[model samples]
Target: MVELSQTLLNLPVLICRLRGDVVQVETWISASGKHGHTGDWLVRDYITGETHLRATSSRYLMIDKKTRKLSFLKEAWADQIKPHVLDCHEYPIIMGDNRKLLQILDVDTADYVRTGLSPLWNDLDINQYVNYHIKYISWILEGAPRSFLESHKLSAMTVEYRKECGRESMLHNLSAVSRNGTSATNSTDHFTEDEGIEFDHSLYLQDGSEVLRARTMWMPKSI
Candidate 1:
C-alpha cells in the first residue's frame, strides 16, 4: 500500500543513455511514521556525478490482503529501519498538491482518448494492485497522440492513485489533454510557457470511476 504512489520526476535536461556510461543509485528513507515511510532515490552518473533522475515513493504495509487496508510499522521494525533514514537534498521537479491540476483538465473535453484492456497478473506484489509505473506507460501508449510522441519526450510526471483493482480484466479508459502550463496551488506557483507542452491524464474504469489521475510534462526532441 502507498500514498501518492511512486512518482518519477525528471530534471529540465534530457536524460540520455550512452555506451560505457556507468550510473549509480542512492536511496534513503526521507520520512517515517506509524502510518508509512517515504523513500527517495537519486540516480547519477558514476564518473561526473551528474544527477539523471529522481523518484519518491510513499509505502505502507498491508494489514489485510482482502480489504487492502494499510498497517502501521511495528516498534521493532521501525527501530531497525531508523538507522537507515536519511534526509534528501534534492526534491521532485513537480511538487505540491496536484488536485487543482487534475481538476482543471476536463476529461470530457480531452484532446485524446484511448481504450484498452489490462489484466492483473498473479506475480504482482502482495497488494495485487496495478503498479503506478505501469499506469504511466499505459497513459503514454493509449493516451498520448502519435505525433506528440514522435516529437516530444517525457520529462516529469506525478500520479495519484484512487481505487484499487484486483485480478480482473480492467477496462482502461485514459484521457489526455494538452495544456500550456500548470495552475497555481497552495505550495506551487502558477507558470506558463510558450514552448514545451504539459499533459494532464485521467484514467477511469468501466463504471466511470477514476482509477488514477496524473500530470506530465514533455520536452521537444532535440535536433
Candidate 2:
C-alpha cells in the first residue's frame, strides 16, 4: 500500500501555461528512511527553462495490506538506493517541516459540519486505495462553498493523509475554521482584501471512522 503523508502545491503554475504546452519535470528523492521518504519535483518550461512550480510529497510504503503497517527498507535495498538520495537542505521548504506541522494541526476537533458523499473506485491506484492527490481534489470539490470558490483561487495547499481509504464509500465532512479572521459558519459571510479563507476537511467511513484529513487555504482572486 502507498500513503501520502503530506503535500505542498504551488498553484500559480496554472496561470503561465496553456493547453498542449510542454514542460519538463525533474523529480528526486529528497529524503529517505526505513518507513517512508520525501520526494520533490521541479517543473519548468522546456524551452526557456523558467521554473513553473515546485511540489514536495511525503510517502510511505506499507508491507501489510490489511493492517496498513509501514514497511522498513532492507539494508541491502537502502544501500542500493543511497546514491539516488539527495540532500534537501538547500531546497526551499514549501510546507515547512512535516513533523512540526503535524503537531499543530488539530485533527481531533469534531468541527466538520458540512457533509457530502465521497465515492471510491478500484482503479484509483495500483494499490487499490484512493490516491492522495485524488483525495485532495475531492476535498476541494466537496468542502469549498460555491461562492467562495468563484471569488478565490487556491494559492497554497497542504494536506496530511492520516489513513488509507479502501474500496468503501466515504462521507466527506467540511468545517470552516475561519473567514477573514472570524469564525465562519458560512464561508461567504466575510470578504476582505488580501485575507483568505481556511477549512478543515475529513473523509470518513459509514461507521464514522476517519480515513483522511486536510487543511487548505485560498486567496482572493486578483481583480
Please list the C-alpha lDDT of all candidates, in the order they appear.
0.60, 0.58
Top model number, lDDT: 1
Top candidate (TM-score): 1
Which residue runs does candidate 2 get wrong by more than 4 Å?
1-16, 32-34, 59-61, 92-95, 98-116, 120-123, 179-192
Predicted candidate 2 versus true structure: per-residue lDDT over 1-223, tens digit per residue:
4333333332323344678889998887755455566777778889888887776676534455556766565566667767988876764335464333322223366344555565557435776666657655656546666787787776555566565666656565655454453344576665556666666555556676665555566666763
At residue 157, give the lDDT of candidate 1.
66
- Per-residue lDDT of 73-170 in model 1, one digit per residue for the tens? 56676677778766555443224545556643345677777776665574255556666566545554567778978877777666666656455645
TM-scores, each model vs. reference: 0.73, 0.72
Cα-based RMSD of candidate 2: 5.2
For model 2, the run of ten residues with the poorest summed lDDT: 98-107
Q: Give model 1's TM-score versus the native structure.
A: 0.73
